[model samples]
Target: MRARAGGIAALVLGAVIWSAAPVSAAPAEGVQRTTIGAAERATALRFWTDARLRSARDLDAPPAASTPPAASAAGGRQAAPGTGEEVRVAPLPAPGAAAAAPALAASDPTPWTGGGLISTTAGKVFFQNAGGGTFACSATVANADNKSLVLTAGHCVVDAGTGEVYRNWVFIPGYANGDRPHGTFTASSLFHLDQYVATAGNANYDLAFARLAPLDGRSLGDTVGAQGIAFNAATGREVHSFGYGGSAAEGNGERLNHCSGVEYPDAGREGSTMWGIDCVQTGGSSGGAFLADFDAGSGGGYLVGDISVSAGSSEYHPVLGNEALDLYRQAGAA
Candidate 1:
């Protein structure tokens, strides 16, 4: 995918330029957190009207380098076994929410008709880049101790080079067109690995977590359920990835689309390790969940990784290792 001017590309470019300055080696272990205060949260919620969402541009994915980096090891410490469990809750109805439609069979980018937890757990993320342009990406509600954490790509939340978190970040769960069935939740804080900040959005640490503020006195998890998350899990498993990516045939990021395929290890520029799958999801799909062991009946699965980069018909996910585990732990506790 080619990087565009207004969305994630600008952030990545900023990070790249910043990394050129004299600096120490990227941190071996550390979590960086950006808190959004109550005032900012309120402003975010008010800023994203239905009109703005419909007009928001897709957050473009960064260009994938053809040559893999020279580093051989995964960037962080070895990952432990998978952890966290799926937390399913009853779906809440939103006024004017779109009715559930049948999902299409397995395809590279097909409509998600499995009307279950995923219909509520997976949603669209909207925010403003440093340039003040509104952009949209995908996100998932992860089962966290706080019941408010959502997972997305790191680039969606922060500009690695400048260490600046995007403004007016909010998530629309079960979003279809302009309908927000579960209401909108503003981001209370953003969390990611320090390595991502130091390395200018390294693919190895492209994942991020956003702690959300409750909407109408209801927490996001209680409102729409949350998916299980796993780290250091085995690769090569058949995975289902969901996103609201825009394409000429894909409803232009207005609807949920999915791809099912087996994942394999792939190397990214700067030695960043990632998981690659055969998928055609394009821009605006960044930060969507890549689930393993997805059950069609329940629409639930373990979140093994997230959409980070796209090259041709393949999409890449960050390998959730020790650094990602620590970031999740911190976000859960926040």
Candidate 2:
């Protein structure tokens, strides 16, 4: 589904151009938070009130023995319960899973096998349009209120250098260097977290979600549709990936799509957002959406995860979990 109010595609576009230079900390003409979540809302008077707030270290850990068993990525690969292995964010999508599949009447697109690569999202906190600059990145149309929503890394939206956010941001789908086929959408909202925004030393969970206004004359999901979001599951038999690497190999256009070999699970990559699977990509590929689809079958593609903030390797994710879901939900709510 396309972002209802102009969602993920815009985020992917912004991230591609982000980090060119630092954006200002201060909000522009309409960058401030006109709306905030329950947590941020309650902070209005809490700072001056009598009770003190707790820091990250102050929170107690859930009892190790009381935690539920975590499913593994491997169909049969087993680990003892509560073993330090990292668990996936949520249960895999199926009829029983809370996650729902997209009503795709169209045959899915095959794994990108073209000569060039597809774009993905790579965000920078202080992104700006100082040079009329445009960045091309990949994004999936995911179901959110039956509308489109873009997903990317938190640092892409929030300023990494300072806690400042970007302003006058827009998403240019299929924006290759300067080739903008889908045109652009003004960003209405950017969703992230205080932890990533601060770039804390041990920050691991670095997901982000953003919203954008609809295109001038068309609707998103109605026109472009969207991919299904996968959660926790052991059913990943094989997956396909895409990206627009700045290498001479990717050629010079956005329409050209380059793809990777079949993806296999890397045990060490578990839990870290920067997880990597062997793939042929480099710097410009960060934030590209990792899609799930059948390369040789009738129904071909759906976006289940995204390329996390790592270079030279692949770390994609299907959006899920309580904490992460809450954060993303709050992003749309805000």
Candidate 3:
């Protein structure tokens, strides 16, 4: 699925849910994880795609008294997207109101993994003139080379409304109470589905990857360590997904929540994911990094996906599919 460059894709109105995807597997270097049974592959992949999308890391502001016509009228429907193939969208939930998720654990406010949100869409829509129109969200630090890179939802940085990109776009890994442990960085380049850049309508297709250029002359990773990224793997495998969102499980406003379990697939090509655990949450929690923290006994986390679409007790993430990895490799990140 390609972002429509300053345009949003056709939306099919319904309940809001969540999402991410990656393709191409580098040779499995770490301990090889077992794959899910082939019999369950079709079923698992089915629901993974058709999940609704929402924002992450912020409190669910009061529901809009009225939804905009453009947001309410999801009239676009096109052919299915490709996976492990060309860029394509998968079948997932419709975007919009679903239900207030159950309470979650209040997460740690201090960022242990050095991650934060990528966009401020939550700030843009819910609060006008807030943060100087500069919004705050969350994301996590990851390293492929010796550079500092972050993983987040596509819409966080890419403003579908204006072709112009984020102005104060910067990263503060290990942020706590506005405390930047790694310092600030302007995004050098952001990578997402061509679908997202083209259309703001596809939240399920929402995802953003980037290379950070330091603003304070402090290089990333040099300032703060980076999390390992897991590629070359299969679904239904056990992993951990952590983020700083509001909840009992995580905490409110500056907190972190980590959930772990096996991953399942979705229906459409976007290649959706259903977390094995339950973390009831609301808006302001999108773009959270999903890490598969299987330490070779080190007890650290390896990032695999980002929070894109979610709803109810369920959260939809984009598993690091094979196709997405190809994009990273093409960009020289992987």
Candidate 4:
């Protein structure tokens, strides 16, 4: 259930519910998976032409004037103590020194001009909803054993309400204007937590991961360096979130923008325990990375959470706990 500030509608379109394709096997407990094979990947690549990619709508774009629904309470039991350990992975060496720019003000959505690994690792995600509506969001490559794992919001991968995953999913790293610097990578598999699936997008479990197929005999991490990821990390720290959010002022999703601020607990209409930052990023920003200890020069940091929802000037993200850690491990192994 990804939403934008200023009365935008949620990403899920309830008018036409659809079903997902058959999975390879039963998913592990508390997890859901959808596999994309070679044939499907080829079809997806053909479907997303340059024109169609440019015309795709932002998932968080404002719809007809109407009041959005209230967010449901966070459901599901808490993870047991010691269930998740703090983990970190160093990023691969990348060119470029840190940029000399002023710290972006809180709640300010500014275009990212610093050229670093982030320019290649964080990119736009395009897919069609279960109802065949073309839409776009944001995602980031994360360091993993397989070197092909991508992290995003759960709703960006599947509709929690219908349990139907999107179609023609593709990630274009270093996407800018209309250029794809690195080749597009298709999703080989998608993973989500059971709580988000069962509860219809509970914000507490809104995180998801994608296992991507290699491009031109190269893995995503090998092509574009990945950001280090962390689970069960301490909160209340400064965070830098990047995404290709659409807005008249931000090139309508053609360029990457970011927001930076200290994180706090969400206390707005969502009524969930997700973390919040003073950011004005809109709908397409969902599934963007919330990085901790980000270095402006190297454009690398530890992925702590992902964009989930936005209310007015504040944006929210799920707390990456044991369940999120488990999902990452599973995706990496896949």
Candidate 5:
């Protein structure tokens, strides 16, 4: 299936991007949820043995030539008709706010060699589509009930055209080439925005959350810990984006890559209000985390967004808004 809304795709500029249809005032507009059965969970676990892990294709590439073109490369829910282009302001979490300087303060994209909470919290997600092809995207653990929530991009969890949830879904936190430091956690169910699943290319609803089944009888949070998530967060602030995307410049996706920058209102397309950053991460990096006020030592921070779309060779966009926060609330309850 073709990618809808947000994800890693080669950016095509100067096109007349269409705006998203107006969404309802209801809190849960475009949200869809489903649970994975025991049998399916068992099958997914067995499917990702060492051999398959070595062979899974990186999902960072744009859709194949035969696939249909996506409606908009803009990633995020369409802003209301007359909202200004300025980045909206929101407050940061209170307790964790500290006086010490940030552990990672650089604005440049850097190779994450190792160490820190992010090492265990962020990892690569693997799934198989109806076409029988194995693919990958980035994902991270989030605090939730059952202590097994895995947050990622909607495009990674659901096929837009068929509305079929991707199968064989498993997350390998801190996954390095051939390394599964935290062991594999399979999903028991997945949740996404209804607008994303119903429409062909709605970036505003491009994110997703999954409730994972325990591996070796231990909950996911207990194993690697979970990151704090936020919605309707303050914009135009410094953010640290982490991913396992293929690096054309570096020539590998085996190691974690991160870029730090302040998010700004994207003005490239009309009818849509998306957040963008200046970073060069490419494919296979889709669904990676866009964290705010990240504490490198703690590996915990507010999950403001995830990798959604390419703005150019060096810039990326992630979705974070009211609808996205509502999706998280619904998923946590599920």
Candidate 6:
């Protein structure tokens, strides 16, 4: 898997749900964490001023290299997309809808208006890369007992090449054209699957959870509300994916962009079972949220996945499984 924006490649692996058994060898290794001290948080806030954000709007990069339309591997010989394997009834009911989603004119897929929770829950993530330069990605606020959890792609938090997690992480919900309507929320810590930290190439575990620090004495959920997250969720859904990434169709990551499509299994690898959508979201959209039965009002829905990697401009995300559940539970507890 690779981020088209950065042109970075990572090793991807077949999907396998790891059990919740303790790793006795490393008792507390299931979830990896890194703290952002006060000094760093203060620096991050000033680093993302209005001017810097506006400059980023024009910085969307090129799409990642494209994969062969089809390739050979092992397990199911790449099931043809839309074989109904991607469509399944959600294991549990999705969150209640507040207002209907934006309506398209049938013939048009353009014109993506930031709607519902999509407006407040989904936002741009900024971090300092290992190179000391700034980069952006998409992310979403997720419901948690602590009211401080955020969901995003693993690579957005950790740089696979240097094996170092990026620093100065901050989330700005409803961010548009360098505007922070809800102000900025810096990350207290970041966590991801041990598998991703170890393999660095396994797209199967590319999702991550971030714990945000309180700003103005309020948790992230207290301000924007959070979306219900489902693990071991049913597949084959008609999903609406959101991101703030550079795209010719999307005003180059200045405004949020999204597309609706059915999820399908990976066509290039055997047993890789990663979920994919037919979208053209570019770099900054890497960590955006994928919502099932999204609502325009309330901004609440079942968070099934996030933008992880791209096959050309099309996007792929790790499906929520047992491993994801464990990560969520541990991150929320923290």
Candidate that would win on TM-score? 4
Give a tens-digit lDDT track for model 1, residues 1-334.
Answer: 2222233353242322322211222222587777778888878888998889988888766543322232223444422222453333222232233444444445578878767778888999999866667888999999888889888998888776677677788999888978987788998888877666665556667789999999889888888888888777777988989988888667789888888887876643444467778776877888998988777756777888888887556788887776677778888888
Candidate 4, residue 70: lDDT: 25
lDDT, residue 162, model 4: 74
Please, what is the TM-score per model? 0.82, 0.54, 0.57, 0.88, 0.78, 0.78
Q: What lDDT does model 5 reach?
A: 0.66
RMSD of each: 6.1, 15.0, 15.9, 4.1, 8.1, 7.8
Model 6: per-residue lDDT, tens digit, 93-117?
A: 1234244365442111254563566
lDDT of each: 0.74, 0.37, 0.42, 0.78, 0.66, 0.66
Displacement of residue 11 (Cα, Å) in model 1 is 7.4
The residue-by-residue lDDT of candidate 3 on 154-267, one tens digit each, is: 556544433223333455554444444344455555555554434443554455565566545655655554556665444566655555554443445354555555566544
- Candidate No. with top lDDT: 4
Worst ten-residue run, lDDT, model 2?
54-63
Per-residue error (Å), model 5, residue 5: 14
Clashing pairs in 1: 15-161, 102-113, 103-113
Count of backbone collisions in candidate 2: 28
- Write one digit per residue (lDDT tens) for candidate 4, span 196-280: 7665556677788999999999988888888899888888989999988888777788998888998998766433667878776
Clashes per candidate (backbone, < 3 Å): 3, 28, 95, 2, 13, 8
The sequence of per-residue lDDT tens digits that candidate 2 reaches over residues 1-334 is 1111112222222233434332332133212232223342233223322121111011110111111123232333322212122233221121111222222221122224321112222111112322333233344444455253666554344444345454444444444444444545445566555434332311243445656556655544344444444443233445555544443545422332334344554344333332234454433343456655522332224444554433223333323334445554554454
Error of 6 at 257 (Å): 1.1
State model 4's lDDT.
Answer: 0.78
TM-score of 1: 0.82
Off by over 4 Å in 3: 1-132, 161-164, 215-218, 247-250, 266-277, 296-299, 330-334
Q: Which model, 1 or 5, shows the larger lDDT?
A: 1
